[model samples]
Target: MTRSEPDVRAEQEALFSTGAEHYARHRPGLPAVLFEALPAGYGRPLTAIEEARLVIDAALDAVSGIAYGVAHNDPELAERGRRTLARLRAERRAPLSPTGDAT
Candidate 1:
């Protein structure tokens, strides 16, 4: 039988609450290699639309990380998520030229 929305939500919440501690304890943190791989800009220049698309993709990734962090009470993950989100917001506000330079 299908469950109602509220019922599904309540069950999900219960599962998350019960599993959060285990998840926080067992989950591995982000690798140092990942931080090292982040660069100041793309290797090659991109158009304004390309830059915008990159920002949107990064924002979606950050949001997913934030949601997982919150659900599992992972402070380090949450902090990284916040930093990624802030960077994305700044990128979104700044205008990009056709050559991907800040305008």
Candidate 2:
């Protein structure tokens, strides 16, 4: 059965709360290949794997920034968090171009 939005979010929050410390400590650094493969913009439809990777990267970036901001008391990290989150939201809302491209 499908889970409701609140259920999904609650589960995710529980998972993060339990693992945030370990995640902060042991999270692998982003591979250069991942960055290299990113398009300059969403000008074409991404493959399923590419889309998943992008989502994960954006989530991680935002979360990591928040953690860093808390640890270091740096406001710039919060700005980065905001930008990354906005990018993710835009990606979700963006419609395909006339040619069925992502842009």
Candidate 3:
């Protein structure tokens, strides 16, 4: 932020780290319908297993334990979130069922 700029500049730009797994961990889970209802640009929907794998990867990535009580908090979960997002993209075009449903 430039010193001359007003304080209400919305911090220049809102941040969106690709690995924000806070939603996957601290936050309550999202609904199945929400994933199925992903916007048209999500590429394709995924099967139950594919979705589960994505979530599992995110959960694992959020673990940032330390030998003592002095560790960086929030689990540094970006990598896992990235993997999950990638999986979601890959699964978008895959048939979700034998009937050829993508979700």
What are the models' TM-scores? Answer: 0.45, 0.43, 0.27
Tens digit of lDDT per residue, candidate 3, span 1-103? 2234532121211111122233545455654343333322245554455544444443343332221213434334444444545654565544456553545
Write model 1 residue lDDT over 1-103, tens digit each, in one string: 1244532332333233223433445665744343233221224444455545556655665677679989999876766667767765664567667676667
In order, candidate lDDTs are 0.52, 0.52, 0.38
**Candidate 1's error at 34, in angstroms?**
9.7
So what's the TM-score on candidate 2? 0.43
> Model 3: number of clashes?
3
lDDT of 1 at 74: 86
Candidate 2 Cα lDDT to native: 0.52
Clash counts for all predictions:
0, 0, 3
- Cα lDDT tens digits, model 2, 1-103, are 1244532332333233323433444565644343333242335555544444446655775788878987899876666676567756776844546554566
lDDT of 1 at 7: 21
In angstroms, how far off is 53's CA in candidate 3?
Answer: 0.4
Stronger candidate by TM-score (1 vs 3): 1
